[model samples]
Structures are given as structure tokens and as C-alpha cells.
Target: MRQQQPAPQAATGTTAGLANAGSKKARPSVWKEYVKTRYLFLLLAPVLIWYAIFAYGPIYGIQLAFKQYQIMDGISGSPWVGFDNFKYLFEASPDFWKVLSNTLRLSLYHIVFGFPAPIILALLFNEIRFNAFKRITQTLTYLPHFLSWVVLSGILFIILSPSTGVVNFLMQKVGIEPIYFLGNGHYFRFTLVVSSIWKEVGWGTIIYLAALASIDPQQYEAAIMDGASRWKQTLHITLPGLLPAIAIMFILRIGGILDAGFDQVLNLYTPGVYSVADIIDTYVYRMGLTQMQFSLTTAVGLFKNVIAFALVLMTNFFVKRAGQEGLL
Candidate 1:
């Protein structure tokens, strides 16, 4: 047997070949696997179709940004203009700059004040040991979120009206002049910020409250044993526990910095506050639908979206670099 034994290299090669052949035979084809999971694909089909139709479908219309967009010619037949619309936005339109500035300022106000409102509310809610009072307070807060912005705007108009509003009546009784909250450009941004926070704070707080509930109770007990006050525990433990959720939310907010609440602004704003309240979305609405400047409107929208997308990417990168999970 020794005299006629195969070489060690040959024997090893044979064994390896046989093993690879066995693996090849054992592995299922992609078609077979797809067939096996056909039911799951069927269940997911509607969502995929919906996104394909509504979400991704609109991406094809981005051509309108770079084209003259003759309605009679349609998207594909429109003549190429090669950045003329963008040039008009950057150079020709004075209103564009004002609109951009207003959008940025409004969004910044929301970030600075409105962003933290929910966190504060959630923390305050957490400290409330009375379950009934907590539930009622939470319900009262979140109920405004379910109301349409139209209804909320109508309520706000009555409440913030300089002459007949309950707020103005109170001010008059206190010997103070009634302020035009919604009408004056000087106060319009402030009104927008305050109204927005009031409308959405409760719904936003629900996320943070859920995050708070997920923190280990044992950590709090240990902190209490170590003579930690509620504030100390919150600063050291609770804040750290909520950091991931906060970072994710912050990144999302940064991504939408240009949006500035289109529906709310449209419903609440008048020509008196146009200088302070005319955001990109409202401008887009006017140009596209009212003025029929379809190409220019498309260019502006594309610009806003590109900037927002970049902001999201940069924010997410910094968040992860700082050792917190972000919305990727």
C-alpha cells in the first residue's frame, strides 16, 4: 500500500474538490429560494408597489428642474435649459433670498426652543407619581396633535387676535397694550414658533416618555441608595439614557430644516407677515400652482431637497463620531 500510495497533495486536492462539489449540490438556487418565500413577497408586494408609484415615482420628474418644462411638450419633450432656473433662483430673484432667510430663521427657532419642549415635558411627566393626573395631563397635551392644523390655526386666530382675543382681553385688564401676534412681521416668527410648539409638543413628548420607560429601574434605585437627588440622577443617568433618542431626533430635525411647517404657515400667514413667514414650501406652492412657473419651482424644490439631504448625512456622521447612534 505504501509503494502505490497517492501523493499527499493529490489526496488533499481530491478531498477539497469533493467537499466543494457537495456544497454546490447542497446550495439552493435563488429562484428556488424565491419560490419558497413567495408568500412573504406577496405580503410585502403592496408596500413595494406603493413606494414605487408614489415615492420613487416622483424622482423621474426631477428632469423638470433642468428643463424649460413646456406643459404641451411634457417632461421628456421639454427643451433642456442647463441650470438657467437655478441661476434665476440665485441671481435674479430677490424674494428667493428673503424666503430662504425666513425658512432658516424659523427652523432655527424651532430647534432652539421647540426641540427641547417635548424633552422637558417628558421629564416633568416622569416625575409625576400620580398616574391619573399624569394620564389626564398627557391626554390634554397630545389632543392638539390630532386636530388638523386648519382647526388649530382657526383657534389660534381667535386666541391671538389683537382686539377680541382672550389673551388681548387679559392684557387690557392688566393695563398693557394688546400686541398683534399674527399680523405684525416683527412678531410673526415668534407666533409661529409658539403656536408650533403648542400644537406638536405633546405628540413629540410621547417618544421621549417611551424612551424614559425603557431605562432600567434598578439604576435609579442604585442612584437613590447612593444619596443621589432626582436632579442628579436625571443629569447623570436619565439624560445619558435619553441621549441616543435625542441624537436621532436632532438629526431628523436638521434634515428638515427647510420645511418650516408648510401647512401651518400657509394657513396662519397673511401678506402682512410675508417678509418673516414666506418659506421655501409656500413660495414653491405660489410659483408652481399660482404663477405657473413650473420649471423654476422644480429647481427650487430640488435645491432645497439636496441641501436637506446633505445636512442629514453630515449630522448623522457627526452624531456617530460623537459615539451616539444616529438615523442612518
Candidate 2:
């Protein structure tokens, strides 16, 4: 015999009913908040509009990379030429390898020598016993950061002049020949790297100084109580505390590996050192603006940006995996 079906229970709520209930709940409105703070929004409106117009707006022109662009035709009207621009850069450009190598080598040198100098300076400054001397030294070092590369380059050129420069004069005292610093390709890259370090090292120290300030005094005191020397305390407590900031800054540096300081290179380099000093930015400026190869220049710029984005993502991933704060 078949059993009789039980009577259906009364519905507490259907899916539509629950959704209606959710919609009807007294919740805060985003528009209401904006209206309440209308004055604040009004103040921010100009900055938002400025960024939309100038900063983010120009991204649309990236299409020029895939097109044969002309000033008369404009971006939208330019004829699309697909991958021809990229093909020309890799296959046809004569200075492609040399410029690429120079850029990479210079960046690597900066990372190797330049990155550590600031950290060491900051640590040394932190260890100074006299406030007056510390302030004087900091002021002297930081003054160079304000000088434009053009002015600084001129100063460097005057100092390194083979005939009458102070550097050559000093070399003569040591009975050694005056080296042709700017004329020689072998020394040009080294000069650029060292000069860049000198110019920016003090400015870079500012960040490390800030990071060092955030380190706890109690940690250092504890180390000292354990009979640790100042150097040991710095190594164990201070350096470890600064690691997160260093890692974040390093990730940012890695992201911009292609950007090996365009302004400095432009000011310091001449035809003699082009093989060792020319970088992608200078190359693009010459090719697109001077030679009128707009499409090819855009392609190179796009490639650099793509690589930068990839580097940032990869570095951030490794940072996260290593249990450290990342640039993201």
C-alpha cells in the first residue's frame, strides 16, 4: 500500500522574499554620504578632473604603437600597421643591442653600489654623537640633490677636464697620466654610475633615515643590556627593522629597471660615449622626435612599460611569498 504524503509546511521565506527583505532594510546610502560631505567632494573635484584629463587620459594614445601615426592624421585616423613597429625595432634598428645592454648594465651597477650607500650613510648618521656636526654633514650632502643634472654635469666636466681640471692636477701630483674620462667609452659608464650615486645618495638616505627613526629604542636598549656593542646592536636590531622598507623600495627599483635616469644620461653623454651611455628613453626621443619614427618609438615605450609591469608583479609575488610587506 502507498503511504499518504505529509502536508507541506507554511513557507517562512522564499528567495524573492529574502531578497526583497534585504532591499528594504534601512542601510546607509553612498549618495547620502556624498551629499552630506558635498563641500569636501567639491574640493576634490578639480584634482580628480585634472588627473582624468592629463594623467589617465593620455593612456588612450598607446594605440599609436600599432599604427602609422602622423600629426595631420592624428591618433584615431592613423593607419594601423599591426606588429611592424615592434619588428623594426628588434630586426632593423642598429643600436638596439648596444643601447639595451648599456641601460641594463648601468641599472645593475646602480643597484649594486648606489642602493647600499644611502643605507650606510643613514646608519652612520644615526650613530653620530654630536647633533651640530650631524646636521652640517646632512645639509652639505643634501645640497647636491637640489642641483639640476645640467649644472651638475657642467661641474663634473670642469672637474674632470684632462688638461686643467682639479682631478687631473691631483693625478699629476701622483705622477700618473691624466685619464680622458669623458672621451673613453670604458670609463664613461663608470663615471655616469658614480656621479649618479654622488648626486642622489643623500636624497636616498632620507627614506632610510625615516625608516631608522621608526625602529624602537627599546630593542637597541635590550641589545645593549646584553653587552652587545653599538655595531652589533645596529646589525641585529636596526638593520632587521629596516628590512621591510628596503624590500618595498627594492621592489619599486626593480619595476623601473629600464628607466636608468634619462635626464642624467642626456646631460652627461655625447657621441663618444653613446655606445655605453645611450638608453631606451634617449633612443626613443631621437627616433620618434628627431627621425620621425613615431610608431616604432611608441612600440619600444610600450615594451618597456610591459616589462616594468611584469617585474613589479613578479617582485611583489616573491615579497609576499617571503612573508614581507610588498609594494602593492
Task: Compute the lDDT of residue 110 as modeled in candidate 1.
Answer: 97
Task: lDDT for model 2, please.
Answer: 0.89
Candidate 1 residue lDDT tens string, 93-204: 9799999999999999999999999999999999999999999999999998999889998999999899999999999999999999999989899988998899899999
Work out the TM-score per prediction. 0.90, 0.88
Q: Give one digit per residue, the lDDT tens place, for model 2 in 1-328.
A: 9997654442434656777878877665889888999999899999999999998998998999999998898999999999988888899889887788888998999999888899899999999989999999999889899999989989989999999899989999999999878878999888888998898888898999999999989988888789999879988898988899889988999999999999998988888888788899899889988999888888999999999999999999998899899977
Candidate with best lDDT: 1
**Steric collisions counted per model:** 0, 0
The window of 10 residues in a row where model 2 has the poorest summed lDDT is 6-15
Can you give the lDDT of residue 185 in candidate 2?
91
